[model samples]
Target: MLSSGVLAGSASVQGPQGEVAQFEYSGSMLRINAAQNDGYALLRDGHFYTVGYNNGQPMVFDAGAMLKGFGDMAPQAIHGDLGAEIASLKDTGENEVVAGIQGDVYEVQFIDDSGAQRSESLVLSTDKRAQELRDALFQMMNFAESMTPGQEKAKAQSQDIRARLSSLNAGILRYGSEVTVTEISGEPVAAQRFELPAQPLDLQGLGKLFGQ
Candidate 1:
């Protein structure tokens, strides 16, 4: 529905600790600058880059390995594709205003990779502006999924969901309680915003920091 060009926006993400995080996206890149932490994350070009500061020293690392490592440490029972959990999506024929945009409400049913059932609600709009923003967000999601390990099944499921949404000419305005688009603009973003501030540290360099 977007005639052409890129969409820029910022969202408010509710953190687990009752704190809010700002998420900015432009084109295919998303940036999360932590407000209370010494690190930030950027998702660009099919990779997630994490930058952290230790005693005023900056360290850049690949996020894929960190995610895999976290998965390895988790209990096996919870090791499932979180992205492939959505089982169905249905329009509820209800309208709601989110962030000043009116959109139709939809219910999403989820069957976790472990087969547990859950559900959530989302507000979707068919506005051209919203569609442009949605496309940018979708691109980031695709890039993030591409870099994740062992996600082929989840990727397939995600593709199906994307197709279904596209068929309805819908774009997300709000996704349950997790994300809300607080502001949007058609402004141009600089290419350098997606560039890494420094080279990522190699595995050896990372291990050296821990005296491994």
Candidate 2:
């Protein structure tokens, strides 16, 4: 799941699936700068868009609508009950250095496919500033993810997420499949980035375009 894809930066690969993928984001936006095309963007504010070139002309539209038009072909949604998903958190008390930062280690223990318990270590800085960094990002991301379907259940799970964030007490410089997370820049992201660049072409008559 590319659920946390926004923060992943540029990547280049050479293989059968070789392509270049880049990401840019604020709290509300995520864009995948992909090869063979400009890329796509997913907005938490109920919008999705794809960018492409037509003799260098820009094309951006509501991707969520496009995906919706796919009906059953829309990507399978992956979800979990966060409370039932985790067995428990175990503090390893181990320390590791990442990008010249020292921090304590903790594990998010859970069950494997075989139904056996397993764990992965996550490093969190003890520095107060680092903790603040973690807190702010966690808060925003928590609110965003909560926007997914399952409102009542989501509300309950979001509470758990917030508590976990507070206890973690540091910005996650890394997580499962998270490429790289640098320090917080405190920069203001433009809200317009979430808006569609051009008037969207309605999918009603555009089935052939998207292979629907």
Candidate 3:
């Protein structure tokens, strides 16, 4: 078992395409430094903070109204044939071992908005230690949602994930090109690290920074 101080690690994308795509990133591709609130991000080039520390109301500020654009880059599925979507999923009941940890693997077989069928693989932790880490991360995630401006809808989706996790005896540790948490440590982090960046650069600066 690990302490609840701070779980920090990085996971470069794996899989064939993932390896090729991971080349562009430098440091950690994602971080969970936020402890009690949702992290913030610019909406493409929009003038508001679409994703941030919302608290059940319109978190409007001088920048702009942080209207929810689906919480930036959330991985769970959303509207548009949610019923049909769930019906299309296929659980291969396949399991794989990675780095001495056992996990269940599954794939999604769904027709995209462009009418193209896409299949994606995800691994769920079955290891006891990994399960504890998954719970900790889930706690942090719920903290973010609890701050949402009227999080009823978002909370429901979050609950769906939680329910599926236990019911299925698994929780997602990685998804697509976005999230992929592997190791967890108990390093202490300053409270200030959980807050938003003092000065977030615009999308243009980000493009240049990443050399895109």
Q: Which of the two, 1 or 2, has more TM-score? A: 1
TM-score for each model? 0.72, 0.54, 0.44
Better of 1 and 2 by lDDT: 1
Rank list by lDDT:
1, 2, 3
Q: What lDDT would each prediction earn against the true structure?
A: 0.65, 0.48, 0.41
Q: List the residue pairs that clash in candidate 2.
A: 48-63, 134-171
Off by over 4 Å in 1: 1-4, 15-17, 65-82, 85-87, 114-116, 190-192, 203-212
Pick by lDDT: which candidate is best?
A: 1
**Shift in Å, residue 145, candidate 1:** 3.0
Worst 10 residues of 2 by lDDT: 8-17
Candidate 2 lDDT, tens digit per residue, 1-212? 11232342222222233343444455545544455665565454645566665887767665555444443333223223232245676668888765456777767775543568766566666554444444434433443343333444434444664467565555444444333333333344455555566666555335334534
Question: Which regions of candidate 2 are displaced past 4 Å?
Answer: 1-37, 42-46, 65-84, 99-101, 112-114, 125-162, 176-179, 182-184, 189-195, 201-212
Quality of model 1 by C-alpha lDDT: 0.65
